[model samples]
Target: MESWLYILCICLILGAAIGFMAGLLGIGGGLIAVPALLHILPQVGVSAEKIPHVAIATSLAAIILTSLSSARAHHKRANIPWPLFKSMLPGFVLGALCSGYISEMIAAKSLQQIFAVFVILMAAQMAFPFKAQSNRDMPSAAHLFIAATVIAVIAALMGIGGGVLLVPFLTWCGLQMRFAVGFSAATGLLIALFGSIGYTLAGWDAAGLPDWTLGYIYLPALVGIVSTSMLMAPIGAKAATTLPTAKLKKIFALFLTLVGLKLVFA
Candidate 1:
């Protein structure tokens, strides 16, 4: 088979697996794809050094579609917190827009290394769940706004869809685990939409990038991953509704730790 065909098949499989994990964990599939693409993308003609940026940008673009599908599926079950969504959207948009410019100035590997550390911390958070000790009420609008801004910045910098920060922050703010996961998934859609556009626009001046590469966006990987993830995300979301996410989240965190370590070394 042609190398391109092999790349497509791998992307499809990775998309499905990542989508399932995203649905189960309330994260954008980018957490998985970013590291995988750091390796896979270089084999398909992208520069080794540029692979991290491409992987992150492509993963973010793919998450826009995956999060939309996952959020819509979960929304039907009355899981989303619409008020929180309203409070966070503005900050999310602003954070996402700023991330692109930030990416241009900072080294891509630096961002990846930082993300590796963040993911390690998040893994520990998921496993131990420190928020379990907090005696807090539902977050206020101001708290949510502040948290949303911070999450948006991190999400944009890491190229995640926002749930990585949103879920934990919501939990710390006193939301139940299930509700936090569901609501964060919904918020991630908006974050990814704005962030993806911003990153693409901001990276337009990057040198030696491929054709059809708008900013840092890799069109081929984006299309392949989104196509499969959109089809599979609903299935994963449905499973989440029926299964135990806490246990799955712990397992997922372990997987994240492994991937995060690889990103650091890559």
Candidate 2:
């Protein structure tokens, strides 16, 4: 097959898979897309050294679209917490701005390594079913502020949608998994919106970026990913409602473990 054709096909498949997984996992889709893009982008002409930054930036950009779609769908289900959303936005904005600057300073490989370790740890935590929930009776405004701060810090540092932290935190705050997932998707949308803007503006002065690139994001990848992920994520969300999540958690953990090792050694 021609290289362009092959790349096109792979990009489409990745978009569908990431979208589906995002809906199923209530993640920002960055965790999956970043790692996969790191592997795939080089073949499509991006320099290997820049692939990780591009992956992270583009994943964030794509999430803006995918998360909006996912959140809207979940909104119809009445799963998002509007009060909490209001409380968190301010912190998210600050964190995103700071993180974008930090991202521009870091090497792509370093970011990938850091993210891999974080994923492995988070996966391990998820696999174990902690059975502990955070206290929620406290003032809603206070907790929302705290949660948003934590999310912004993590999202910027980890270069992931805030969903990974938000979902678990919300679940710990006593929301059911389904509601937590939906709300987290909504939060992810917010993070993406602010984070992408921050990264783009911060990296505006960055040099040697490609034609399809904006700051750190690669436009082609964003379009390919967002379009397909939006269409397919609901499928994953539907399956998540009916599936044995514990088993899926175990599998996802194993996958992350392997990917972490591969990234570390590569």
Candidate 3:
């Protein structure tokens, strides 16, 4: 009982940080949540073979709330571009819906390794920001669909909200930074919603899951994370408008690099 309480406390604290970062950076909180849960879930009795699955699924579940809160805050600021969001919604839904089935086929170790590589690459992208030589208009509908689908598939596999990829893609397509971030936040909600559902359905009959699980989603972690993340997201959204985030991004990039390397070698 005492240990459970301790774990819940840690989850709450982690959720607060994840929420804040999600709102501040428009990242859906999965990047942090996946790594944190990987450490936390094993302490609660999740089996080694299922650890990555639970961590990723639970992170996506948590992101459903975190991203919604962040999206609402960004919406209030009028940052989201509605037409683009609408245009990409179908593809996001389709790709995320398929991700769980795809993940179920992969070995847990392979999934972890894949996530580690993704994290390292994302860290590099964040550490050295990309700049497009010339701003261009949105691509054709088919192009948008392909891009959104691919991004959603990757994001779902990694338990991310897709902002890490989406924001950069949007900016490269001539959207302003603020708008791109906001748009990414909105799209993250869709990804998380469908992605979590897919995971839940896929793992419904799986063995060795810990108690209080909804398929692969761990209830305690999800509840604890959402509880604090929802509250902190608005605060983070407020901070984003005032903070100088370039330095912060670099610091976060370094943190991600370390986490990725640790996962790779562990």
Q: Order the candidate numbers by TM-score, best to worst.
A: 3, 2, 1
- Each model's lDDT comes to 0.76, 0.74, 0.87
Give residue 67's error in model 1 in angstroms.
1.3
Clashes of each: 0, 0, 0
Task: List model 2 lDDT by residue over 1-266, tens digit each.
Answer: 75445655777889999888766865557778878888887776666556776777777888777667667888999987676667777877777766777776778778778888887777777677554455565347767787687787667566577766776677777777777778777877777777887778776766655666787777777777777887897798899999986688788878988888788778
Q: Order the candidates by lDDT, highest first.
A: 3, 1, 2
**What lDDT tens digits, residue by residue, belong to model 1 across residues 106-185?**
67678778879888877887787665424588767777677778888788778787775677677777777777778877
True lDDT of residue 259, candidate 1: 78
TM-scores for all predictions: 0.83, 0.84, 0.89
Question: Comparing candidate 1 with candidate 3, which one achieves the higher lDDT?
Answer: 3
Predicted structure 2, TM vs. truth? 0.84
- Model 3 misplaced regions, further than 4 Å: 2-6, 23-28, 234-245
**Candidate 1 whole-model C-alpha lDDT, 0 to 1:** 0.76
Overall local distance difference test of candidate 2: 0.74
Residue 92 of model 2 has an lDDT of: 78
- The superposed Cα distance between candidate 3 and the true structure at residue 161, in angstroms, equals 0.6
